[model samples]
Target chain A: MKKLIFIFVLLIFSFSYAYQFYGIPYLQQVNDFSLINQDGKKIKFSDFKGKYLLVFFGYTYCPDVCPTSMLRISDVLDELGDYKKYVKVLFISVDPERDTPKALKKFISFYDKTGKYIVGLTGKPEDIKKVAKQFRAFYQKVPVKNKEVGYLVDHSAYIYLVDPKGIIRMIYRPDNDDPKRIAEDIKQIIKMFGTGE
Target chain B: MKKFIIFLLTGFIFLAYGNEIIIKDPWIRAVPPSSKNTALFMTIVNKSDKQDTLISVKTDIAKIVMIHKTVEENGIMKMKHVDSLSIPPHSEVKLKPGGLHIMIMGLKRPIKEGEEVKINLFFKNSGNIEILAPVLRR
Candidate 1:
């Protein structure tokens, strides 16, 4: 009877564990690259070694998805509370031609209320493309009808969660639009990776 | 007496046709001044037994407004312009983030939080209705 009860409990636990959440664990190791941050300073990927980085690739001109994702990341950071100290959000602009260091600084600062953990990065078009390719991301520029608006970019909307050791641990999909769930996932990753709360 | 009869007929017609669709929680996410495109969100409920199609949206704040659907194809998110959206009978259709939305392009002016923007939505069966969507900071 004791053995049967233990097996039943294990079965219940396994059933619950089979359920999946919003973010997907990719487990692909990330490579480091140097890019200019929002402060006009050249920062290397190694500079963020000990911190969990929430990386998102978007342009400054993107009004809906980019801003909404940034806001969601900010909300997750806020919900992390004291644990927020361990996390850093990076906004990498794919539109290198238009999104200069100054443009990125102004655009990223608008969404972040605290403005401490969030940082914007932009580099040369080639470098940006190379970095995006390393992460298996895609972006394309399409011309629009308006003369004033030259073009708009269609890109992947996945937000990547990088561990302290620079591994792409989890990815928040565009369809998974809940911020609170993302906070919970971050906490889970921190605990699993033994990265200090 | 003739005027009263005409008013009663109009009221009956409105009750039969116009009062079926209810617009709820309509709002636009506030964007920075430099950003050019923004999306509008709302929950539209069809209370009547018949279905309705949302044909188009118009706003003075923007030069063109298109109904768009965001789809994830091969892990890349892309927005496709849709002609009309169907709202089933006794059902609700939500225009939310990362889903269906009204895409406002060519912003004439920057929108601020708490500012009300007037929008006209034209439907195939229910005709046109005006909504004042408050600019909300998300």
Candidate 2:
């Protein structure tokens, strides 16, 4: 009886460990909020209802991780190919004080010159804080000794994949997740959810 | 004639005992027209028997340049300033994306793709080395 029980426990643990999605499964309905986009237009969470939303929290001043994440996202979109039409990438700035709409526009244009695929968003600090809390994203401004650079913002760099129905379905580490795998995951989610269109 | 011979001999000796630090594939991240910051990536190989430390970096494209390392703790990515990076003897140190990098801030002008930028790197024992790095998106 003890041997049988141990076997059953091991099977249960293995079953639980096996996840369906390539990214970490995070199934929840994301709260809706409003923030200003790079075009200086107020965009609400509901505005992206019919498309899969790839949300990332970062700042424009981030030279290493932020740009790397952006490039990864661009590659993922490229991998999506025809499916890219049903997806949108959102880069939310945690440092709203320095990331004005104009600055955000210029920074995002570097990745997407047409400015049609990726959207850079920034708003009031408290409003950004609320939105960050909704996604459980953390960011803090740490002052540096250098007078020219002023300060740096340390932030979480996870890419959240929200389904077309406004439900958070998966999360990816920008530094670790492969673009092809992420693209396949998005396709799987689309096939299962029917794009919610 | 004696002084000339001595000078030539000293020149030959100095050439034979010079620093053996080699830099490869150095490139700077290209930024948008209005952006003010970028990062540089490269691989430094020290062929000499003695270790050397990279002390400072200077560039005319940006007002401030510093060595920074991107560290991830508790799922948060943070950039930390590194005073110097030491390259071990007969080993190579990489400064790449999502790792060690040279952070350049307060750009005097936009760095577009396909352009070349000159940078001066000062080493503890290797002295000053100049490199022209191409601006690339990667």
Candidate 3:
């Protein structure tokens, strides 16, 4: 009886410490789409086949939340350092109309100092909308009264962690957005997939 | 140890103000030209024995600068403009990314890193505190 009780307590402890994914898993494959990179080169999602892709959707005009999220991810990548070779960062522009390929390049480079691991992607409006819908991301433009201020786009903030097979394994929310935690989660995913271990 | 260094730095930085009300490490987040709004963050320490209220903030580069708080609503983050913020006696209030912040709207120019911007902060009893905030990538 004591041995069984000990085993039960150990199981409960492990379950409590296990990481939970906030997104749907194994439900559907991420939609394939062609988007122009910062250099105007056309690329597809499957191009990132062997490495983990950290996909984030936001625009350059976003001031606070978007930059903070990007910075957090960049910090994670920075912490990974040499192990960063096993991962890639994808920044998708939801506001394609305003965020041109050239502007996206400059915007992403600002956050990523070395400009090595991050790829900024933008395409036509319909394509962006289609991809966002596939990922269950929401973005809407709201008009503001100020002329200089123009309008603001309210977008759903989520960092999707895609496995080596282009399957999203987990979703990160803004509430628990920490660089250390994200880096730890990525390491865990890489270990589970047995691709980068 | 970090907090202690920050406290010492805050003391040294605010020595010119006679330690009445101190602001430590105030910085503005740099934004692109297309962005209409940006945020400012800092640590406000009330060295006085009485509580104080931050009434308003003004910057010439921005047409409208207001105090805003970021609150989570049903898992979606939303920003609400606030009229004022209070700093208790001998306590520090941090204006950070996911919490209270100063919002700058209608930007005349892009907030670039390595540049310093001036802002005038109004307090109910402490009077006006003019601060020079450096633009940093947050």
Candidate 4:
């Protein structure tokens, strides 16, 4: 009985420690959504099963925040090294009007030219809105004064870490989180809960 | 007499080149092929006694060059066009990623890594200063 009580205490401690993640802990199943990938092929969220997804919402036209986040995500993938095969980065465009499949392909190629790891997704405005709602991501178009540059899109820059089972396990703010720490957390998650593979 | 003449030449050189606005670590973010846009970042140092304002930027590679600042509110990121950036005397202004940057749009061609982009920065006090910013990923 004493050994059983000691074992129970140890398990509780381990569970609590395991839950500590560098990003915000969010252990809820993600809602599935369909969108068009960079190749103009239809893709569903469930299709990424058995692999972790690093998802963020932005537009290709955004020269500042989007590229910064993309670079950070690339660094995170670099930090993963050999384990990057088990991880995938998803860049969902909120500006459907300008972010067509071809444009997305051009944008993502700067980060991942081979197109094996990083995937850019876009769809109709309504469909994009629906997916953004599912992930609680906010985005809106704001018209600018410049004629050559018609408008800009404002978006939330939270990077969601979805597990292999389509569950969002962590949230990272690129402004605050380091890529190395984010990669470490993903590795910890994979160790704690086997990569569903 | 030789020492005095050398001292005078050095003073003349300082008078001609010293106290000018200095640009450090100027670079353009390298984008993919067929990309229409990218951003430039650098640190503007003002050593003069008067404040200077960066009124406009011009580049031949892009159709439009605008000063833009990324503002974050309630976790939302928005890029706002800045008419001018003011650099105080004896201080430095950093235009970096996720903050103030020079937005270059409508690129004529892909700016690959290791390439240099010539840009002209017009300042209120310093007039136009030309620089060649290297294209880089960081």
lDDT of each: 0.83, 0.87, 0.79, 0.87
Rank order (by lDDT, best first): 2, 4, 1, 3
- Model 1, TM vs. native: 0.84
Model 3 residue B125 CA deviation (Å) reads: 3.7
Compose the digit string of candidate 2's lDDT tens values, residues A114-195.
6778999999999999999988999999887878788989999999999887878788975666888899888877775576
Which ranges in model 2 have alpha carbons more than 4 Å from their true place? Answer: A1-20, B1-18
Ranking, DockQ, top scorer first: 2, 4, 1, 3
Every candidate's DockQ is 0.49, 0.75, 0.28, 0.60
DockQ of 4: 0.60
lDDT of 4 at A8: 42
Write down the TM-score of every candidate: 0.84, 0.89, 0.78, 0.89
lDDT of 4 by residue, B1-138 (tens): 999999999897765444479999999998777667799999999987678899999999998899999888888988888989999988999998888999998888888899998999998878899999999987
Error of 3 at A170 (Å): 1.3
Lowest-lDDT window of 10 residues in candidate 2 chain A? Answer: A11-20
Pairs in steric clash, model 1: none
True contacts kept of 3: 0.31
- What value of lDDT does candidate 3 attain over all alpha carbons? 0.79
Candidate 3: segments with Cα more than 4 A from true spot: A1-28, B1-20, B31-37, B46-53, B86-92, B106-115
Give the higher-TM-score candidate: 3 or 4.
Answer: 4
